[model samples]
Target: MIELNQVSAIQQQTQVFNQVSLKIGYNERVAILGPNGAGKSTLLKLINREIYPVERAGSYLKLFGNETVNLWALRSKIGFVSQDMQEDYTPYTSALDVVTSGFFGSMGTHAHLQPSDDQVALARTLMKQLCMDIDEQRMFQRLSTGQKRRLLLARARVHHPQALILDEPTSGLDMGASLGLLSLMRNFCGEGRAMIITTHHIDEIIPEIDRVILINQGQLIDDGPKNEILTSEKLSDLYQTSLQVSQNDGWYRCWHG
Candidate 1:
């Protein structure tokens, strides 16, 4: 489980978050929603320890029930997929190589050793499951925007980490591909594994998600069951505009009036 205690972040003298606290448990699917510049991305960064929150004296953020662990040890258990893939990926690298590098769980490995056969096989399997059939040998820069996003997701799951944190996983995907990605996430739930996704679109919130965390101006407005907190009234307040929140066959849709 990942827990936060009065977690707040300050960057460049701006308070990205303030006294925020939340808990993510096993089999729990959480959605962090807010308008752009609402500190949604900053909150994810705080959880992964990518950047420390301001005045985080003690017990600000705890991962896997530990307050202290070696940096490398902590990253090994967390899988993160961010929208900014250009910086993390090698433009000329192969799709297979991109996924295999997830085992290293860092930007890029400096070693010259080739990945083992098992590693390569696992990468291919993940790609197939995500509906990514591009040639494994294709250069990373050659794929389209949506294809690149799917490849990054495969990369995150390559090592099979216990927790998956995705930022705008469906940013550039079409309807069919977006649904496929959500299905892939639904499979990740169970056996002490959890997935947290941050998305602005209501349609991207999969039905299997058990929890919803709504943020506005760096503050948590609501955090509870999807059905309970993701309603017309609550959503209206979050966006500060009238919205019609509806559900159809386990999918959510919200519209501005």
Candidate 2:
């Protein structure tokens, strides 16, 4: 559902992507894997229209078959959940208000932009599915890291978007919380929706995500099926170290040899 043709982007006066080209299809599960400052976040911003690529010959970016789209309309088609979003809400914002605000793409509910009863119900249902119903009236800043992440997940899915874009989704969680969030992501994709994940951890690349795109130092390193691209040799070279990679039950892991 996204097409980038020789696209290059710059952020903060630094080039983040150089002649990057790729395609992500509807209902596809893919991961943009890379280390810190590897342009992974920049690429996500490009897709989310938070940044623009440098214009040059034979370079273009398109989303959903069009070069330009209304941001409001696009939000309904692709839900984005990021760490920055979790930090953007006011400390006193209620958990329920955070989810319901998805309808207006706001950080929280305000008197002038309140969510309707149906929207509130939808948000509650999503929170319940994520096992976060108990935190409905709790203040946003009072919850633990995992709870905040799940609340953001509910916020993203409340609109029933066709696709979800998650950035570093499980960065700061205990093992149980991380796995729980990953499981929830898998269930979301099972409902005929697409998922595009950006992460540096191999464990976060769920089994349903068959495609893995490796990026390092603002350049595309590799793009192919998971089995082919996630080999010991490939990962070792990507991370610039001696590493051991293993797979079990379709899950892959890597560590120093």
Candidate 3:
């Protein structure tokens, strides 16, 4: 679903990601895990075309099949969500309006933008599929974090994307909210779309993700099956600290000694 060939990205005179050669197929579920400053977010931006890679001979970034896909077209195929996206939302925007904005890939529905009957129907259907139970007219800021997250997911998938990319899907949530988010993520996964989530918590790499990619200091460090890449020593090295990895019911998490 994604191909990066010797890709390097620099922003504001600082190199955030470099030489990240990787290929992910259309159906494989994957996670990109690294500590803060590991260039995980930069990589996602590159894939999502929110940022550009450094120009160099033989450097390329392609989604699905072609490098020429328009950003709008690219977005329709891949749904992206992140903490910053949540913060960018208009506090007074209603849940339905938020989802409606997804039709145009805008931050939130604005006065200039109007939703058609079909668009409203699809948005409501998506909200239902994601199990969003909030009153459609409730303002985004008034909703709980978990509810907001679900609304964002509904917004992201309003166009029915072929893949989903999440950055820190469970950040700023308690155990209950985190699990609730996970359950929604699993439902999204059940729709048979490719999923790539970048996270600091091992438990966020839900069972649906079969592959894991490790990044650090703006470089792609490791790429392989989740089980092989998520070992105690590897987790320790990835975080730059000594740690022990634990697993229960196919979920993984780590703790420092």
Candidate 4:
């Protein structure tokens, strides 16, 4: 389980979130929604330990029911896929090498400890599962934006972490690519894994999502089951705009006047 008790985060002298509290139990798939500048990305950074909360604010961030688990040890168990994948790719690395690099937490390009043949096979399998057919030997820098995002996410899962954190995983994807990514995410939800995805759009919410967390202006606005928190009235109130929300099959759509 992941728990945040009265947690606050500050970066560059700016308060990102204030006194936010949330709990995510095992096997829960959560979608985080908010308007622009709501600190959604910052919150994901907090979970990944990219930044720490201010000590004077009496904030606490805990993972897996423990107060003091070694963060490095904990990191190996969490898969993080962020929107910022432009900086890590190299012009010369092959696709297979890129995926293999994820086994040791490298950014899909850098040289690290060699992964085993079984790991290589798994990487290829994941690529096939995602409907991607790029040459395994193709240069990393040559793939399209959508391909990069999918490859990066597949890299994160090479270790099969206990939890997954995805920040705007489909931000730049087209319709086909987005569906492929969402399908892959749904396949990850099971009896023992946990996932927290930060996204602002309705289409990004997977059908397997069990909960929703809403934030605005760096404060947690709502946190509850997806069925209860994603209503038209609640979302309109949260975004401070008149919006129509509808459910089709198991997904949601937002209609604007």
Per-residue lDDT of candidate 1, residues 67-109 (tens digit) = 6656666666778888775446778887777788877765554
Top of the candidates by lDDT? 2
Q: What is the lDDT of residue 124 in candidate 4?
A: 95
- Return the candidate ranking by lDDT, descending: 2, 3, 4, 1
Q: Which stretches of candidate 3 lie over 4 Å from their true place?
A: none
Worst 10 residues of 4 by lDDT: 104-113
Superior candidate under lDDT, 3 versus 4: 3
Rate residue 79 of model 1 by lDDT: 80
Candidate 2 clashes between residue pairs 3 or more apart in a chain or in different chains: 1-24
Residue clash pairs of candidate 1: none
Return the lDDT, model 2, position 249.
93
lDDT for model 3: 0.87
TM-score of 3: 0.96
Model 2, 233: alpha-carbon shift in Å?
Answer: 0.3
Tens digit of lDDT per residue, candidate 4, span 208-244?
8878999999988888888888888998998888988
In order, candidate lDDTs are: 0.80, 0.91, 0.87, 0.81
lDDT of 2: 0.91
Instruction: Please report the TM-score between candidate 2 and the true structure.
Output: 0.97
- Error at 240, model 4, angstroms: 1.9
Model 2, residue 161: displacement in angstroms?
0.9
lDDT of candidate 3 over 75-157, digit per residue (tens): 79888889989988889999999899988888877778999999999998988877775699999999888888888888888
